[model samples]
Structures are given as structure tokens and as C-alpha cells.
Target chain A: MIRFDNVTKRYAGGHEGVSEICLEVDAGELVFLTGHSGAGKTTLLKLLALIERPTRGQVLLNGRNVGRLPARAIPEHRRGLGMVFQDHKLLPDRTVFENVSLPLIIAGLGRREIARRVRAALDQVGLLSRESSRPDALSTGEQQRVGIARAVVGRPRLLIADEPTGNLDPDLSLEIMMLFRRLNGVGVTMLIATHDLALVQELGGRRVILEGGRVSGEQD
Target chain B: MRLWLTRHVQNCLAAMGRLVQRPAGSLLTIAVIGIALALPAGLNVLVRNGEVLAGGWESARDFSVYLKPGEELAQAATLAKSLSANSNVDDVEIISAEAALADFQQSGSFEGALTGLDNNPLPHTLVVRPRPEAPASELAELARELGKDTSVDQVRLDTEWVERLNAILEFVRRGIWLAAGLLAIAVVVIVGNTIRLDIENRRAEIEVAKLLGATDAFVRRPFLYTGFWYGLGGGLFALVVVLVGLAVLGGPVARLSALYGASFQLQGLAGSGALTVLGGGLVAGLVGAWFAVSQHLTAIQPKI
Candidate 1:
């Protein structure tokens, strides 16, 4: 479902975010992307999400060159993939239900369908009772759960999470990782970027390691 | 089809709810717009009333032609008859010197003022009324033509005040247009600033929405609707202000007209006029909102 052919992204100051990175992940595959700070893990995921364009070479998703996607098609393209950020990115002013309903709302879903899907997503995240509570009022883990619920609520075929467990304690982090494993067991493809090698080892997933601006190794 | 309508209605309601949530700020903006609209509308009513009053003085457009001293009454009568037959002349009345003296005597206040004269001092005069549709310039031309006649000493038209009134009315009309235009721009600026602040306050929410796949148009919908509501409310308020102004002036205007032996009524806005005011408000609001959102929304993309 994803392929990168010698993709290179360079910043304005001549710093290389990622260089000549060639990678592929088949459909329905769950993979971990591990790297140290500034190792281009976030930049790599951003390229796949079409949030940033590759400075060279081609980035393909579902057999289509994403770098050539028109500006008007960006939202439509994004709607097909769920994305999670380390900060949760939940709207502080919105309730948990509203936060989760954002994706379906953008898709122009009917109110009844949005409500139904939002409740189910919240239920999956185990925050069904806090649906009406504002994100700021929720605990850090709960807010992260709301963010996950938002991402999966759209039923996207691919989920790209950038350090989803970065802000959580080890216990909560494990719980969140277990949640990702359960989602993967149900055949939802996921590519998670993290620096936690021990957690990757514990989860026992295929790992793609980045060092400096290049993919250093791959392990299964 | 129903779903589209439902979403639009929901968006409109949501916009209204946001305005209502901050009632004081919204009300102040609306009141400013209302006052701006009312000024021009009230001036327009004054212009209308001036036109009506000018129409009532149409008969005063006639000319009084005074024949040269020693001209015969018979000559004046013949002149009046000839003027009456002219296509431009509606009618002509001839007043002999005897009749003029008799009119002056009947006024009582001027009873003996003219008695010392051995003969009547007043000359034979012909009052010439032009066609009712005659323009002031055309009537002035006719007056100049009459002055060329050897038998006439002077031709005096009582239309000077009417001309001055018309000039004043024109000046006022242009002033009203200028005021209206400036106020419209003010409305746009006011609404644009308000929308800008709203966007700023909701910056984080907007960024989150965009990240969640919301299009620029989808994000802009609520702010546009907010502008719509503001314009609508402002227009209605302006209409009320104008109507109440007319009502307050109506009684005094009627009394003044009665003193002049005339009946006059203040005219309020008809159905179409009210609609126009409301429509103007809506358009200004929509345009202002569009400008604000388009400028600020692009700058608010999620940083990723």
C-alpha cells in the first residue's frame, strides 16, 4: 500500500531531513519505524501522509504518485488515511465526541451516522462515558485515546502514528501499544514511528531503523 | 437534497448561536451598522417629500407680462387672446389698468395709497400660463421672447424659488449617495474586522479542523453565516429606526401642512424598500465575511 523510491527531502538551510530513502510496506502489514531524535522518522511519515513533498524521487501510495496530487485533492487524499500526533492534536475547546467526529464531519457524513460512528470509536478507546467532556478536562491518556478514536473513526485503510505513546508513562504506553496490536489483529494497516526500541522489541513487529538521514537496518 | 439543506440550516443555526453567545459585542456591531444605514434612508425620505412639495407649486410657473405705460386695454386683451392660441401657452388672463386699480383698492391696506393718482398707475398686464409639462428652461425662453415684444415692458416669472429648491434637492441627493457609499464601506470594514477577530480566537480549532480533513470552504462556512446574521440584524434595526423617525415627525408635519391649508402625510418604507435594506445588509455581511476568511484561512494550515 506504500512505496518510496529514493525519496530525498532537504530543508531550506541545506539540512537533509531524509535522503534517498527507498521503502515499501504491503497492504494490511503492521510495521514500526524507529529512529533517534532528528533521524527523519517524522519527516518520512510526513512524506507518506503528503504533508510534505519529497525534494527528489517519487513517493507512491496505493500505486499512485502522491507528489503529483493537485492542491484541491489534498483533503480528499488525507481523508483516506488516519493520522495521529504525539501531542494528540485534539481540539481543546471541543468535547471528546466532537473531537472524534471531526473526520466524519469532514467527509460530509450524516449526523446520525457521525453520532453512531463516534460512539463506537469512543467505546473502542474505552472512553464512551467521557464523550461530552472537553479534551482539556480529560487526563493525558484519555486525550490521547480521543485522538486515536478520531483517527480510526473514519475507518481509514492506513493509519500513520507519529510517536503515539511519546507522552505517556511506561504502563500507559504499553496499554496504547496493546491497543495498536489489537487494531492490527483486525487487519488495519499501521506504520508507527517511535524511538522506544524496547517497546518495539516487546511488541515483536517488523522494524525499519533510521540513522542520520538514511534507513540503517531492517529486522523481522 | 434534504441532507444538503439540513447541513446548511445547521450551519446557519450554529453561526447564530455563536453570535448569541457573545451578545454585547454583536449588538454593538449591529447598532453601528444600523445607524449608518438609517442616515441615508432618512435623507432619501426628505428628498421624496421635497419633490412632492415642489410638485404642488407647479401653478407658480406662469409669467406676468406688463404692457408699456399708456398701452390700451384693448391692446392687452388682444395680446392675451393671441397668447392663449399659441401652442406653448395654456391660458392667458388680461387685467386692464382699471381692474388692477380696483384690486389694489379692495385690499383696504392699500386703499388711499393709490387714490392720490389722477389716473391708475398700474399698466395693462397679461398673465400667461405655459403648458403644465413645460420645463423651467423652456418657460424662461418664452419669457425672453415675450420681453422682445414692443408692447411689453417686463416679463416676470415666479419660478426663481422653485429653481433654487430644485438645486438644493440635487445637492442633497448627491450628498445622500456619498454618505450611503461611505457607510457601506464602513459596514464592510466593521464586519471584516469582527470576523478577523473571530478567526483569531478560533485559530487552534481551525488548525485542528484542517488537520482532520476539513476543506477551506467547510471551515469558512460558519464565519460567513455569522456575517450574514450580523448584516440581517443590522438591516432590520435600521429599518426600525427610519420608521420610528417618520412616525415621530408625522404628527408635526401634518399640523404644519394644515396651517398652510394643505394635507400632507409622511411616507414610510413600502415592502420593496424594506426588502432592499435587508438585502443590502446581507450582501455587505457576506462580502465582508468572505474577504476576511479568504485572507486568514490560508495562513492557518496545520504545521504537521
Candidate 2:
């Protein structure tokens, strides 16, 4: 569950990242955030991730005020929600398995347990065969799937992704979208930000559109 | 507990792997630390050898108490017995004036010159050997006490060389400690600089780890272990340097001592001294790594 009631974030140079925004999503829902460039989608996701705080009003997660969370508690909060970035953010020096195992490792799982969960998550992302292959050897879509596997390895209830398919071809993007649909079928709440309007139309999910740092419209 | 220990083991191995990835750089850093530590270690060993050689010469320090001319031989013998009873005095022997004159006549080429004299000019003397462990100050005190006797003319103690050697040794010991302190700071600095560069090179990896919800402590663990390895290697290498130095000097020293008609052996650091060197290196490495990690890790949060 999530709630953002009239939250505004302003940068130090007097640039408003998001202004007087209001949004909410019930549990077990998959929502797509779409807008043009500088539409404040990334800023909204950052507030949810606690990477940036709202300048005014409040951002809540399951009725808890995350805008008020202290710096020391940010790590634990981030760990509770899985995050996927547009660039995949995979360590190029490590193998795909090692990259995916990172979240479970941070959670301090035992070696056997970590191995088991990493294999299962990689299987879900169709990256099981490329476990020992380094990220540099993988294609763009596979790298993004590796990132998805890493985010979901710890079985977080809520997942937030920023431009997950921004680097993929149309066919690869549709494959990745199907992967998200499968995850949502398993009751993992998903909030994905993207500007891919065609994919949004094809997916036929609840959509929130942002324009100039404000929620301009919504479609069901 | 099991998971925590497992993570530590993983981090330690990971650190070792990273070091091995750049073997030349790691070994060079270790060697610098070894030589830096070896300077003080070698100096300490040499000082100890000097003390041993001085200790051999120290036992000969003694006192010569001269009785007044024409003093009775019997009174001189009684003075020797009383002086021997003091706790500080190890032994005392009285030499009668007649015996002294005869010995002087045989040892010197002045027998004919001495026979021309009507009477023996030598006075009864007591040879006093103080306890081996007695300090120079205590020896001086005993000599002063002997001079207070009515039959005693002059008390002469041969302790100048002993006092001078002790003072020199004290000065060298303090100098070595000062050098050791400054060099210790150098070791810490060397390790800190190494770790700082390591953090810089791994900036991207650190950012990814932090974004994956890795705590600062988790990011710091591997760097600390790398420091630990560097310190440990340097410590062992320093001990090796000292041992080899002692070995090279040992043969020439023994030959020199043989030329002097004395058999002296070169001594290296004892167990406790070696332990101190190793412990100092380890602590320095850990502290240096800690400073670098704390200063640099906080500045490297995920910027997205």
C-alpha cells in the first residue's frame, strides 16, 4: 500500500521537482507512471525510495511517514522495497549470479539459502542459464532482467522501477513487460515509471500521467 | 551468528582476491611497511647487544682503599674484615705493606732502586670488590663510608667507565624510542593512503552496493580486511629483516671478539620484543584503514 498526499519537492536552485502532487495505490496493484521528460516521475519514485525527501506535505507507505525517516533508518527502509533502474546498475566486474545475489547477501542470508533463492529468482527472470556469465557479456534485455532478479531476490512486497525498458528493443521490451505481469499475478505490488506509451496501451493497466511536476491525468 | 561469521569470512576472502588482482602494488606496499618497521627493530637488537658487551666489562668495577703509612698490618686486616661484612661489599682482601713491596719489586724493573731505600714506602691496602648488581651510586656511597675510617688514607673507585657506558646506553635507548614513535605514524600514514586509493578505484562498486541497501559497515568490511593483510605481511617481513641482519653481522662479530681474546655472541630480539613489533603493525594497519573508510565511504552515497 502507498500514499502521497500533496507532496512537493524543491531543489536547492529553486527548481521544483514535483509540486503539490497527490497519489495512492492499494496493495496488490500494478500501476504505470508515464509522462514526457522532466515530468517528475523519477523524483516521485525517489521520494518513495527515500533517496530524496518531499519539501512539503507527506509521503506515506502503508500509513507510515517515510518523509520523516532519519538518515540512519534509510537503508532498512530501502531494503523493504525492491528497486530497478533504467541502466540496470549491475556491477560489470561480477557475474550475473553475483549481481542478483547482492540483495540476499545484504539481508545476511546463509550461503545455502542465498544460493537457493538466487537460483529461483534468476529462473523467474529467465536468466538461470546465464548465472555465471558476466554482465558485459549479456545483452541489454538480459542485463535488465538480471537487475529485476536482483531487486526481487529478497521477495520484497513492493517493487519500484524507473524506466525499466528504456534501453530495450520493442520485442525485448514486451518480453520484460510480460515478466512484470507474471510478478504482479503473484501479488507483488509494482509501480513502474516509463515514457513508453505504446507499451502502456498494450499492457492495459491503471496509468498515472504526470505533467510539469503535477499529476495531470489518470486512466483505468 | 553463523551468517555474520560467514559474511566476515566472505569479505576477508574477497579482500584477499582484490589484493591479488594487483600483486605488484600490494607487495610493494608490504615491503615499504616492512622496511619502515625494520629500522626500529634492528636498532633495538643492536642496542641489546651493546648492553651485553658492556655487562661483561661491568663486573670488574672495584675499589682500592689505602691505609695510612706506618699503619699496623693487624689493624688493616681488621678493617678488611669489617668492610667485607657490608651488604654492598662482595669481598675484601688486605695486602700487607711487605707483600705489596715484594710484588711491586718483582713486577717492575725497580728492584735495585727499591733496595736502596731504608724502609718500605708502600702502605697496607684493601682490595674491595662490590656486589655485581650494586649500582654505581651505591658503590660511591660505600667508598665514602670507608674513607670515614681513621686508618684509611684514600678510597679510589674505578667506576667512571661503567657510569659513562650506562649513560650512553640510556641515551641511545631513548633515541630509538623516539624514532620508533615517528616511524609508527609513518606506517599508519602509508596504510591509510593505500586504503584511500583503493576506495577511489572501487567507487562504482561501492555505489552499487550502497544502492542495493548495503550498509556503510558492509562496504567498509572488505577494505578493513585488506588493511589487516597488509599490516600482517609487513610485520612478519620486518621480523625477517631483523633476523637476517643479525645473522649477517653475527659471524664478523664473533671473529672480532676472538681477536680480542673474548668469546662474545650477538643477541637478537627476545620473544616479547618480536611480539611487540607484530602487534604494532597489526594495530596500525587496522586504524589506518578505519580512517580512510570512514572519511571516504560517507561521501559516496548513490547519487540517483
In order, what lDDT does every prediction score?
A: 0.89, 0.91
DockQ of candidate 2 compared with the true complex:
0.70
- RMSD in Å for all candidates: 3.2, 2.6
- Mark the regions of model 1 whose C-alpha exceeds 4 Å error after superposition: B66-134, B150-154, B255-262
Tens-place lDDT digits, model 2, residues A164-189 = 99999999999998999899899999
TM-score for candidate 2: 0.93
Candidate 2, overall lDDT?
A: 0.91
List model 1 lDDT by residue over B157-233, tens digit each. Answer: 88989889988999999999999889888888889999999999999889878777788889999999999998999
Estimate, for each residue in B193-295, the C-alpha lDDT of model 2 and write its tens digit. Answer: 9999999998998988888788888889999999999888889989999999988998999999999999898998899999988998988889889989999
CAPRI docking class of candidate 1: medium
Clashing pairs for predicted structure model 2, backbone only: none
The list of candidate 2 runs beyond 4 A from truth reads B72-124, B130-138, B141-145
B188 Cα displacement, candidate 2 (Å)? 0.9
